[model samples]
Target: MNTLQHGFQLNYGNTDVMLLFEGQPDHLVPCTSQILLDSDLFLVAGRMVGHSFLHGGPALAGISEAVVDVLFGASPDMTTITVEDCPDLERRQTIQLLDGNKDLSEEEKDAVWKLADMWDLPGVTSDNRKWLFSRLLQHAVLGRTDKQIKQFRRGLKETCIWQLLTERKDVIPLMFPRERDVEIKPQMVLDQILWPLETTNEDEDYPVETRCRIAGYLREFIATASQSSLRGLVQFWTGWEVPSSDMQLEIVQGSLPKASTCFKSLRLPGHYTNFKDFSQDLNACVATCDTGFGLV
Candidate 1:
């Protein structure tokens, strides 16, 4: 399941382009790939979703709501489409220009007209320009990708979770949450840490300053870390990119920051006197720790 998750979400370790869905991190909408469609990859994607859910794997969250709505039988008019779901930048830019500006500049009008002609969509009139904008958003997002969506639905049904997915619409948010819904926060990773006994001895007359300083550095790093950095931390501490409930932290006086994936524990060096050294070493370890036995 993790392997499947990596292939879809990370595109088999290549992020420059995708073979299936498109959009920002958590708002993915399927972009039509004729080659992949012919190969039935989307159907396989559907099965991945079902199997992942059943087997307790990745949530595969961030799927665009429009795609989720259609997967669960929403009609064209009923599906909620967002501008982000439009995979084409030019068309999306034109739609954005048309969204609220009824009095478009001549250049903007030309862009929209060009987009309409490009897609064979209805042309814009001064009065109907607003209507055109909405239709363009819908078309760019879902209209052109209808068959791909259907294939995804068919694949999902093959896993027999379609009924539950359709009947319990509330589960949509849980199954395929919005990007913001599942985005990792600094405190989230901090909460996952089981601080060492040395750091916990707050009332002691003499504290384990080495342990506390390194532990504090870890906390500080997480607090200011990028999304990818935190994800790397999770992937390092656990075998997967998701955080676990029982991650332990151990401070060793001379060792570098490393994790025991099977134990969900992070062992950090306790000798660091400054945040820069600590962060640099920690970042180096995280950068190369996503693969097997990756500790340096």
Candidate 2:
């Protein structure tokens, strides 16, 4: 899914045309490309989004809400189209000029005129600029790309999620989450950790002080880690791109931090004398996982 997001940001075949999505990275809309459409890229992208949703993978974040509204079969009027939705900078700026009180010079108006002609819209007069702007915004963001949106919907239905999506409109935010839509906090990861009571300092049968210290270091690292670091830590701990319900973390007396992906358990060395050592070793452990390991 991460790779998919990166690929979605790129142009197709040096054409400056979008393959699956358009606009800025944070406000992407589906792109209409006949070549890609013939190859079923939109359908496959939608199916991947559905599959990721069903299998505890990352949400397809950064898609514009207006586009999402359209994706889920909402009327074009139901969405609020803005200049930001227009992918072309020159066109977006032109659309913005339509709203300003300053009259556009002939040069400024030329691009808008061409776009209007291309879309079969009437030439803009003071009285009609607003209407023309609305139509141009619609055509740029929605009208020209309606077919791609349809294929996206059809692809999602192929994954058997169309009914669920249509029936529950509220979960739309979760389906294509914005960064603000889902914030992963330190306490959230802490809460998910499955700790062994025996490793606590309160346990009398064993000298568990090292485990307690290492666990404190773990908490501090998690609390101070950046969002990307935290995400990678979670993935390393659980083999899940996103957080899961059962994250079993342990502190053993010897060795670098290790993990059992199948069990969603992360084992850290209890011998760490300081937070720096613990954090460094833990980061090293998370940074690499070329092979698998397990506890006997």
For residue 35, give model 2's deviation from the true position in Å.
4.8
- Candidate 2 residue-wise lDDT, 99-211, digit = tens: 76688999778878888898898888889988888888988899988888888888889999888888998877888988565667899899989865654464332356656
Which runs of model 1 end up more than 4 angstroms from their true locations?
1-16, 25-27, 55-57, 95-122, 125-134, 198-213, 252-255, 289-294
RMSD to the hidden true structure, all candidates: 5.0, 4.3
The most accurate candidate by lDDT is 2
Cα lDDT, model 2, residue 158: 96
- Global local distance difference test of model 2: 0.78
Of candidate 2, the 10-residue stretch with the lowest lDDT total is 287-296
Q: How would you encode candidate 1's per-residue C-alpha lDDT over 182-241 as one tens digit per residue?
A: 678988878878886754465543358767777788889999999888888887787666
TM per model? 0.76, 0.82
